[model samples]
Target: MGEGGKRKSRQEDAPAPPSHRILTADELGLLKVSEVPAGDKWEETAAKQRWGAPDKAQGITRLQVHCPDWSSDRCLVAAARTSGRVTLHAGSDGGDLGSFRAAPPASTSGRSDTSTNAVQALRFARPEGSQQLLIATATLGGHVSVHRCPVEAALSTALAGRVVQTWEEAARLQTIGDLQAMDVSSSGRYVAVGGEGHQLKVWDLEAAGGAAAAAAAGADGSTPKAGEPLFAGKAGKPSRSGLQDLAHVTALAFVPGQDDKQVLVGTAKHKLWLYDTRAGRKPQAELVWGEGRITTLQPQPDGSRIWVGNGRGHVEALDLRAAPAKLSMGHALKGVAGSIRALALHPSEPLIASVSLDRHLRVHHAIKRGSLAKLYLKQALTGVAWLPPLPPAPADGAREEEEEEEEEEQARAAAEEADGDAEEEEEQQQHNGRGARGKGKHAGRGKADGGSKPPAKKQDSKRRKQ
Candidate 1:
């Protein structure tokens, strides 16, 4: 490429996202935050009957959804409360399904009850194989517990009518918390939890097998012996993460890939650290984004970029391709008066969902670098997650044979259609179809070159008249 061509290529590499909202709710159901129920009924229940009545804590703090299978269109959303309650709401329109909680340790002598504990973190992950769903819960200054969700039965009960499912602990970990942050890896093999503590611990799911399950059956819960983890922030390591004073690990994520060797961590000191678990304990790369502290970490669906939310209410994109990563871009969440709470990216779409202390849910249209829709939910929005497509229902009854043939035909047709569209998009990108800068001798030869007229024409005409 020539000098001009190189310059143009660089410009095209990161063409600023268009500054307008080009997509709408009608285009994608996930982008339809405006239609999301205000959760007023939930708020009312909380106020009148739930924690709001007793002033135990606050309202919902985290939201997570799951589509049992990715081929179906609907999902189940579970919202966790700061006062230690997790409620399930199923379907596109948030309808109450069931409420669940960890069975209090046996033989408490009525000493400690549900009201005394608060749910610190909540997440839903599907473990591989026989297990359909796993509900991971952490409580402040307490151990972490996992519950096996009987999804189909729960859904059946919800369909039959409003119902509740009391969850029994499937597994237990003795790690105590004010466990401020928690994340499960893409492979579901690991759960990382850290916060308000000196060490960031990564627990192996496989390790939670026999002993952990046996312990879950005991009273008062079994704490892991010696309380060691796969990895911990230890002193004499290669990174500054070791605490001489007090430090908190505010954000954590497993870097996107099947190998899953790398994890990205953010600290209260405005630093982003990348660590390779396969390698030793030291951080591989650390880049600082000077806002306040780093609060949320979102790795792009593609591993090329990591989007970060900071305590200063600004979101910045970090280019991981660089040797030492550099901030490529930054923008503030719309209507945010306080720090950004969470960022959830669509599984396959170019959109991001964000919630803030300002009590708004904003869906960012990535193609535009602007919000597609902002809805005022009027609640303290803390965390959010995107639910993938649900699994397809099994074919049955007399028409099963005919339906299988039709399904095959439809699948073939959809594949071809997708291929054609992909080709068209590639060509469009290649040609720079719209608003291209005309080059060479024809650069200014257009219908209206408004600013290209000879500079002295008017002066010459005046002199001629004189």
Candidate 2:
């Protein structure tokens, strides 16, 4: 080929410089396109790779987040597990902080019996004017205990808290069956427990006089005489004919702003009852909520609405203002695959998180009832709780150390100036032929870098002489 032809080919191959190039709108945005997971189709390969053999001992049964009235920000999460232990996790990342056995050890084996000791329910509360955070755990074996959890205790293997109060269902009442649901009032003064059959009871912790009376009640950490419930109400029909099939309270919630005065109880008979303790023992209103058994009831912070989940894989937002009606229809939320075991509201956002028996964790828009995100957890998920967003960290550690270093350097400079001034005065009297008074007048003068400035004494002496 000729030299001119070769040169033309080389020029065509050379790229343009930045000044000669132009970018499209898509390129300017720096966006990249990626494929989303196929709709509703399980990724079998990914699931197998992510999850190992399932273990029932590690299965989480219930979750509760600590939220004091003074601070609604994200805090520690308590997870009740099948192994009869309540594990504490950091709300920010779901990291396991510590765990304590909620069930007593087997008397014969000296170890916990996981099968009979599985925790069924748990709640967190803080009393008025008190700084201690309390956790109450109820086991399948009809034993309940309350513990005081310190905020700074985060050791993974250490026990999290001490038992402050304890009671056994067998000791308190002979007929109250397995505890299915339990809740602490807003004031943390009263506790309510209900379960299979017509067993509904409330206990006043303040009247029991805390742990002093509890410890004296029994030697094995059992409350021999845990005082009678403040209000006890039968859940089902007054007639004895259908009582066997209708009288199971599966869920309970104390009204948010009611201060233990009002309670919402959900029964197996597909009925939601509003009980006013001050009025009478009978439920004030009975509204049919769903077709199946009510599994969980979560009230809003403002007490305006309540989120209800049932055994039929339905989540509904009920308007409390229109409640007590014979047949009330709540806005049904979609995208749930299996029966939801638990639901938790976000601390600040209008978002709710739920975990179901289908091994899926889902987050949804609370208002729109639209699915935000759904994740296949690959393990039977019994509970989910949202931790408060962690507070902004203080400017400490290295930053504080740097500040202290600066302060120390300034202090050292001042000490050096004091010593230097003493030496200067000595030198003036010994060698500089200056009068003692004249040298004494300069005592107040020092370098500003040493954090010392000239005083008004020297100027005052000069003014007096004038």
Candidate 3:
């Protein structure tokens, strides 16, 4: 090759040094594009991964929050898995405190498919004035077990994140069919179990301890066992009017009414049935929603409304004002994409948390009526329960009263201000009338006295001031 041809090849291969380069430090916003995740891999790359990834844990089937002390948001979260394991976590930070293998009830000792009877329902119920928490779990094979777990003791296991709880059983209500759904009242007085048969078996938990004085004996004549029913009676029955073939009670919620008599039940036939335990077992009213089978029911804190989640990935609020009710799907939550598996309300904050088949946990603001905090856990969460909002701390009572007084004082001040404005308006009208009369008199005087001096200096001063 000739020297000229070789030099041209070398020039082409050599990197250019004449290109323009930055003379000053780059601004942060100038590199925004470099920080953005690829559109196709949105979830794979994002900034708001505060709770971290679900990869840190296994499939989270169910989760319930237990706040024993109402004054603090610090609470223990209990999560159950289809693998026959129940884990306790810190609700504030989602930190694992411990995980324990759930012991199958004595009757199911021989079965290998114990996992089939995984945690179907999990709730934390605190009896009135009780410091301890009652963790109720329902499984596939009709085993309903309750354990009395102390919050401090359970949370201390955070050091050994997988240690088991040694708490004894509080109550166990077993039935004949698969325990499909159940609910414990906020007052922790009644435990209603529903799956098969005409009505749900309602048990009085206060008398579950073999105490005959507190628990009246059952009419069925079954001798009460320890942590068993003091009295067991059917609490809900299928309505005769419209819902054809009431298949199964999918979910239950004891509405926090003026009394503990009303309970809401969801049926397989796309209906929300309200049963009054005080009345006969038949549903008092039925709301035929859409075609999707109702899967979960959550009541508002005030008991004025209920949030219903169905199998078709829809969530709506049902107003419980009238009988023979019909729920119109009005507030369908936005950005929800799969069958909703669970719904939970923040105990204190006005937020609603929901889990779905889409493997996402969404926390929504109740008033704003939109999804606020959302996280993808990559787990099919079946159920979620928030620890009831803490009662006002004793120290806060005085502050609350002061706030009420301040509000009352402000309202009274506003009323007084309105009155002052009304008086001022009346006085101004009177002054305007007097000025008009004076002007008329002055004009008549000017007509009589010929081409008058600009109405007295007083009128001029008043007019200038006005």
Candidate 4:
């Protein structure tokens, strides 16, 4: 075939390989939950020790736990209590990460000294090319604080090195409502603050000053000049339901990729909105998680799957690539009577760490498949997060493919050079024999044999090269 025709045929015959594989825990070399450290058995033991005793209450209102992604070298956890004191725990073994007390804001009419605030949300920002930063937000006082966690080697316990850098209120009661939920962007430069307000504000951490200045301006009723918005989509009109009618954003997560412009927000009314930070207007796309409110929504590292926790204590695995939307029920924990406080996926493993009001911090495995096992934590698991996974290893197959192509090109060039030399030798022989054969009486017979000789030699060389 002609060169162009051959190229077209090869293009049409090329096979497209699958991008990802759906493997179970056993197939992927993941051990059973009971075998891993901080597994369910340990949780059960801790639970019995804490709750199994007669003096202890069976139900817990708060739980503070951290499941750092496999990529994380260390994890930090802190829980706020009714006494206005925040107790920080470093690891599952009860190592101290740190502890600090947040006083109630003076502006409120209540007894500021005695009243306590609950920690509504906690998160560690994983920005590209930067160290992780820990952030905690309070429910009642609208207090948000940023802290610098010391490296693991610098401290005896995870909490030992925590240093509070800044504390500030997020918004005013008039413009932005009470802070219901909070999330930090993957870039670590921006924090998407959403709550009782109908609007979602993105905070730039690197902005000239710190969050304190913005928070102070927001807390005092002085109309702070509007700064550039993180998202510029058309602001949703408020309804009688207060923040519920507006963008009642309950959960926030940054899209997992190098370019940190995309964010996903889950609302109390079961609406899922994808916002482009550059656009600054209405949502790019809005979809419903289910018929119930979306308590938690987490995007997978690949950005192909989203794990959603609904109000029904049931988690759903969403196949973003499937037509008509494929939804699979993940694991269902029996004691999750209240809303799911937190959902965390392991960085490299298939395990899922979930915290609920049921006073149990449970770890589930193979959520996409039917198998469900629980890692039992005795306390009401309020919050859980995995340390981000390590960077992926470079692919060996890609390097091999490049090496093979280089070798093939060298062989093709050698074959072409050999062909050229053979052609030149045949021409030289014909020229040398021309005058002698023509002068002879047997010139006609000699010419016939000569023609066959060159053609036969050319065919033989071509075969050998092949």
Most accurate candidate by TM-score: 2
TM-score of 1: 0.62
Candidate 1 total steric clashes: 10
- Model 3 clash count equals 2
lDDT of 4: 0.50
For all predicted structures, in order, the TM-scores are 0.62, 0.63, 0.60, 0.55
Q: Can you write out model 1's per-residue Cα lDDT over 1-466, one digit (the tens) per residue?
A: 7655654554445322112111111101122223222321111211111111222243555666666553223466666665566766654335566676632432268565554345666777765564456778766655566776566654442343545555656666656456667777766667777777644678876677556766657795645441678887532233466545355777777777636677777878777777777767766676667768888888886777778888787776776665234435454344344678878777667777776667665676655676566655545566666544223233233244456558879999999999999999989877774436445336655524645455468878989999
The weakest ten consecutive residues by lDDT in model 1 span 20-29
By TM-score, the candidates rank as 2, 1, 3, 4
The CA lDDT of each predicted structure is 0.59, 0.62, 0.60, 0.50
Better of 1 and 3 by TM-score: 1
Which should have the higher TM-score, number 3 or number 4? Answer: 3
Which candidate leads in lDDT?
2
Q: After superposition, how far is residue 195 of candidate 4 from its true place, in Å?
A: 2.0
Tens digit of per-residue lDDT, candidate 3, span 34-92: 01122322233222213323432344455666564632235566766665556665544
lDDT of 2 by residue, 1-466 (tens): 9755654555555432211100000101111111112342222212111111245556667766664331322345566767777766543334445567776654547754446577777887767776556777777666666667443332122223422222222212111447788887878777788887655688776655454355657577654345467889765445455433556889999988876788888888777888878877878777776688889998999987889998888899767775445325466777876887888786667877776778666667788888866666544556665433223343334454566668889999999999999999888767756565566666634433334334566778889999
State residue 215's C-alpha deviation in candidate 1, in Å.
Answer: 2.0
